[model samples]
Target: MTFNHIDFYDIPHVSSALETKTNSRINNCSSSVSKFILLGFSCTRDIQILLISIFSGTYISTLIGNLCIICAVRCDLRLQTPMYILLANFSFLEMCYINATVPNILANLFSEKKTISFSGCFLQFYFFFSMGTTETFFLSVMAFDRYLAICRPLHYATIMTVQRCFRMGACCWVCGFLCFLLPVYLISQLPFCCHNTIDHFLCDPGPLIKLSCSPAPTTEMICALYNSVLIFSTFLFVTSSYTLVIRAVLRVPSAEGRKKAFSTCGSHLAVVSLFYGSIMVVYVSPTAGNPAGMQKIVTLFYSVLTPLVNPLIYSLRNKEMKEVLRKLFRTVR
Candidate 1:
């Protein structure tokens, strides 16, 4: 999608000829332009080159990995169960999740001009967080699925039918986007006068909020509370579901059955930990007095690393997935 080309150098606040920026709301927050400079990974030329190379490879590998899972699940008849179906949905989500941040990151890394249009910034902000939220909901649903399959075996098939799984997936996508509307909308409406340069790669709420011309304590609190509720509720739900799952698995007489159950949950748990671990540090934890650099590191970890890890965690270790991927390779050759 093409956006209006605005030279970042032309940004009034960025120029040396600019008037001294003040805390005063009227003088600082009234930017008529529709762009923001994304200060993405400011480092030496050599470091930038190395980062570009690393993330380029990572991005390609992540895309290929997730796409393979989506294709394998869709093409293979035996893999059409609720678990694989949800896996495919998660794969698609990862694609979007990575795509939202990485491509712009690459573009910014390669060029000296590191700017994103205002529309693009918020679009990234909205979609990236929305995708994260969707993934959270999906994880919760997957945990519930596992809990049902392991804990209530007889009713599993009945509860998580093909139609039902699709419905749940759709609901996750819809709810994720809808839930954040108020917060994002309110944040976007805030007058950003301090400076247009976002310290992080994308339009993150914490940094974006700080650039506000005036202190908006109420808005900040509302956003924080909204995020806290979502993060804690879903996290607790997933944990609770797994607790029940562990209980059910322990009841199984055979060690083999227990091992099999754990194997399935292990991959998901790892992915969840990586995603939530980095995210909680950045978002759920105290953002009140944190340094921008710390926030940058935390955001980079989840936005770049987690998506890269997801395909490996989900697709590679599974024997059936390996077989499907091999067949796909052979067919292409």
Candidate 2:
């Protein structure tokens, strides 16, 4: 699809005398722009240092937080169950997702040139998409696990067997990787004429779409529909699963039993709420007059902060995760 050409350089013509002088002084300016400038958080020197420090801390914390989850899950025999196994997968995916964006962002913040090559930008987007897709599917699978555990307690063991859980996890990764391939491929086909300044910190789809010199209505529509469907269907599945879980909890004879069930599911619910809430706010909300600053804040929440939080939410609140951590600590000691 073709789009209206958007000029990046609006050079004003000078008088003949000035033009003659300028022409004499300059060589040909005909090189195709091969790199894009990423104007990340700060333009000020002090603010750049501050931003670097903050993101460095966040990146380190993200790695440690996610690694702790993986180590905890692996060390504790009790957490060898399907739920924690799923949590391990999530932690790993989160690490990859955060790594895709944060380190490069941090590097750019400190460097003299805050730019990425065209290929490098697309590669970043690829990993980001792959990890993001995997996380979405993993969350959906986790919801299903909770559904079975709460709604059909007696059959939970029978239905959510280790083999079944592994299959589900594999499917999540495969499907996510496959689903995002088309969009990435489509993006690679479009020729970027000279305008390469990406407004946001990373190569996100929305801003990239805006940069496209080619018309992208169909691509945008397809992406919008695909994203909406994935978000909606997974959300609906989670909602339905939780509804049944709540119903089953209500039917329990003792208050303690209901409380126990609620406590178990609480962390997952919190994660779902945080993730879907931020996503809806960013993508679903109207963007006509939205400021660039606000968009960056929202983008940071999902792309940067959410990954850091997921491992913490699960490890801190879930007893199985806590048990795993305790065992891991003992083993190291």
- Candidate 2: RMSD to truth: 7.8
Itemize residue pairs with steric clashes in candidate 2.
3-215
> How many backbone clashes are present in model 2?
1
Residue 65, model 2: lDDT of: 92
Give the distance in Å from residue 187's predicted Cα in candidate 2 to where it truly belongs: 2.3
Query: How many clashes (backbone N, Cα, C below 3 Å) per candidate?
Result: 2, 1
Model 1 bad stretches (over 4 Å): 1-29
Once fitted onto the true fold, the runs of candidate 2 whose alpha carbons sit more than 4 angstroms away are 1-31, 287-289
Error of 1 at 280 (Å): 0.9
**Predictions in order: lDDT:** 0.86, 0.80
Q: Which candidate is the best by TM-score?
A: 1
Question: Where does candidate 2 have its weakest 10-residue lDDT segment?
Answer: 22-31
